[model samples]
Target: MYTLNANEAKTKFGAMLMKVQSEPVEIIKNGSPVAVVVSLDEYNKIEQLKMELVKSRFENIDESDLVDGKTFREELNAGKYD
Candidate 1:
């Protein structure tokens, strides 16, 4: 991981992007951390793992706990997985 102040990040934006390919970059503002920059592949891998973890957590739930049909479909498509 790498850390950079906001001003330094802005001044070396392109170079920072290249650096992110190897590891995440933390951006700080007002002397505190604010954001992280990661490569697209890294972001995708993280999201996929998150989704899988969410799914696994529900695997042991009883069928009675789930809503029926249309309502379930609606919630499923409404970003409820996250």
Candidate 2:
């Protein structure tokens, strides 16, 4: 990862775009971190990992613990979880 100030990033936008293809670049402004630039492939990989995490967490759910939408809404309105 590489850090670049706002002015440097603006002046070297093309180079920043190229560098992000190889590694993430952190943009900072006024000495505080602002944003991270990443390649499309890296972004997709991160999204895939997030999806896999969600799937793994839900895969072990028991059918008996499931509730219908209407029942859930009713319970929510009744403050059952409060």
Candidate 3:
């Protein structure tokens, strides 16, 4: 990871962003870490992983029954089991 103070980051924003594209970079303010910058590919990979996790978690649900059923809130309040 690379650390950049506010002034340094402000004066060299483009270079800092380029550095982050190769690895992680940390922006600091008042001697404390404030934020992280990551490459777009890394960000996209994280988003894709999240979607896969959500899809797997809901894989057991029957798609046909999802549209056929009453509203979700109604089913929940009715103590229905899938």
The 0-to-1 C-alpha lDDT of every candidate, in the order given, reads: 0.95, 0.96, 0.87
TM-score of 1: 0.74
**Cα lDDT of model 2 overall?**
0.96
| 1-82: candidate 3 lDDT, tens digit per residue | 8999988999999999889888988889999999888999989998999999999979887766564345877877788755
lDDT of 1 by residue, 1-82 (tens): 7999999999999999999999999999999999999999999999999999999989889977878889878988997876
lDDT of 2 by residue, 1-82 (tens): 8999999999999999999999999999999999999999999999999999999989999998799999999999999989
TM-score of each: 0.74, 0.76, 0.66
Regions of candidate 2 where Cα sits further than 4 Å from its true position: 63-82
Model 3 steric clash pairs: none
Best by lDDT: 2
Backbone clash tally (model 3):
0
Total backbone collisions for each predicted model = 0, 0, 0
After aligning candidate 3 to the native by TM-score, how far in Å is the CA of 31 from where it should be?
1.8
Instruction: Please give the TM-score that candidate 3 achieves against the real structure.
Output: 0.66
